[model samples]
Target: MSTPLKRPYRRRNVAKLLARLHPKGITEPFAGGRSTAPERETALDIAGALGAAGQAGPAQRLAIHVLCLRWWPGLFEGPSRVVGYRSVAPTAPPPSMSRSMRCVAPCTPKPALARVPVERPAETAAFRALADLIGSRLAIRIERDRAAQDADLIRHLAAWVHGDARPNTSAAKGVADECLHDDLAARVLAPTFLASWARAVIAEYRNPNHCPSCHGYGERLQLTAVAGSRARVDVASCDHCIGQGVMPWSKKRRAQQLVIGEHPFRQYLNAYHEGALALLRELEHRGAILLLRHLGSDLAMDTE
Candidate 1:
């Protein structure tokens, strides 16, 4: 029978130290575990350190990143696959069981509203400050070739916007195919395109007719009774606006505001409104992807 080999004395000592340090087993020390409290505290410390080092933008980003990681860990992982499918046939519930499910009427989704882009200097400054944070902490670098291609594509798009804003019939089969088909490109350039689109919309269209009660604020403050027999001020959606800051204007009013005939105004408004809605939808859809990309870049830098 072969004798069992024992671990070296030095190795045993190191293992003992690690076991003492961890309390539990030292296997996969760096792997994700159930101890989220420590992670939260560590994240707070990192944010504080970054802030103290005069990296406010990075600190803010790190805080946001930590919050996202806590709330939506699945965002960093792959899509879940359905392991099995259920039977198509429906079964009757138990006789003793009470069915509490109610039939709810389906409602149409409201159309997105077109709005003027209000210039915010403070926001712009903060955005610029994030450039350094992204560059240094995230370590996201675009290749020269890729950067050039993007610039060229942006120039082409800008030229098209400056022109009659018509799709090239020779190249594109239809407006939908031309605009909505390129998902990756749309996601990558959503921010830039949305900014330009907003500016154009503001310049071309009239200001939205704001709600009278809320005065463009979607919510209102109301006093409500609490469990302690005390009233507290709570912010709620404005009843008059139905949570939308802007109210829909009549055709006549819209046409008068645009200083154009109703027929022409309708056609123009529809085109612009549809485009705005599409861009907004694209941004909303791709927002998570962008956040993940940034977070991944930051993590990659740290790992390196």
Candidate 2:
């Protein structure tokens, strides 16, 4: 009978070890097996992750890119809208898990050590910042685009301020109220605030949820290897989020969090509809002035 080949056994061993392969971003239980790249992320890292997560379309992506550039223009080089990351130093294993692990018996080719990207404060902030910028940009873009196409808002403004106050003389003190109305609407850019509801609407469009860590869900899947004689995949509670699902950026939880949430910037989102309608009615100015005032407080004025 032909003898069993030594190469085959070595190859089989390699295959077994690889069967339990854990790539970056995947949760593993080893104490220090995590990758350290995420500890100090450049802007490119955050943008790359965001691009990979998949936003709705180009406009949404542009909105987010602009927002990031606005917030931290110098954090990274290159366009935020694309995934071309600035060259980073080669990844090194974490201190505790730095020992080289390899198949003892020779195989055709050995498996390279896996690299895990750790999510640190800066990277987490980038994700949260991108989400906020995208949401706000979407709101303003849609509202203003729609308003630009419709003239009713301008007409109403003119109607409310229909005539100009005459100086009790022959000269027309102001252009016909219609002209003045269109001018005001143009100045306020159709007063996107009316679509103040657009903030929440666009947010919902993006399927905005709660905790960044778990996408608002409170638990994450923990993958464990079977202990004794066999290799099997088992599910366990995620110790990272403490099963709370939300990963907060703070002193205790320092490693880059895999989960995403809105805990950092949700307060910045504006919901005009939630405000008292009576307050809007109390404005003494004509429709044009009142509309402009409403839009002045917005963080999202230009949609381009």
Candidate 3:
């Protein structure tokens, strides 16, 4: 009798056997096993756990997506392409034209960390809208003149929550100034009075010595052009005084002021700087929270 024929082992059967033996090891074999599905599922789980589901709308979804992007940016990667090939062959010319050029195939380009084209525009719009909404809710006027600064504040807030750098101090100070000015205006503080008050406070703390170049005037006039009968003059702030009209007070002078200071006097002088900083910190902290809330609501409305 002829010998029985034996079946050959195949990769498919081996893979299936492994998958059965260790179900968790292979998610899906021979089906482009690497996928973003797990990443998406994890994102959804995070969102749900963070109270982002249920009544959450498009704005909320968008905000969640933004957070997801920050965490797992690879999930949003676009279809990759091979831009160009590189030569792996020797630098010397081939012996014959018929010889094949030994070239290495190009790798699929990775998405740039800073470039998320599809969602960036929408993300920007969301931030701006959040800024505006937060401003409105907080009773802070988003003036057209300072719109750019306000937008920057919103961007900073977004960066902060996403584990990036904090907001710029100058930007925060600017916003604080605007808020203070608005509050004073609402109380019907006269502009001239406000200016005089600021000048008085500054003068009290400033060194008694005036800037010699400007002689107590912040600006100095310079002859710009000479015509036949008339001369053009331009006024510029004195570089030495930096437009303050007085020299900066020394540490010794500050100590002397403290020695003469009563409790009220100390508080008054400290308020000039400390009060503004405190206001800025509060605004930034509260604004960040409100912005995220508004972003979710807006995103939900958009989806509907």
Local distance difference test, per candidate? Answer: 0.39, 0.33, 0.40
State which candidate, 2 or 3, has the greater TM-score: 3
Runs with alpha carbons beyond 4 Å of true place in candidate 2? 1-22, 29-140, 143-152, 163-304
Which order, best to worst by TM-score? 1, 3, 2
Error of 3 at 227 (Å): 8.1
TM-score of each: 0.25, 0.19, 0.20
Deviating ranges (above 4 Å) for candidate 1: 1-200, 203-206, 227-229, 248-250, 256-260, 263-304
As for lDDT, the candidate ahead, 2 or 3, is 3
> Which of the two, 1 or 2, has more lDDT?
1
lDDT of 3 by residue, 88-114 (tens): 434554344222333342343333333
Clashes of each: 0, 8, 5
Task: Count backbone clashes in candidate 1.
Answer: 0
In the predicted model 3, the residue pairs found to clash are 57-300, 58-299, 58-300, 59-299, 59-300
lDDT agreement of model 2 with the native: 0.33
Report the C-alpha lDDT of model 2 over 2-67, residue by residue, as the tens digit. 545333322222112212222232223211233444433233444453354226456444433433
Query: Is 1 or 3 the stronger prediction by TM-score?
Result: 1
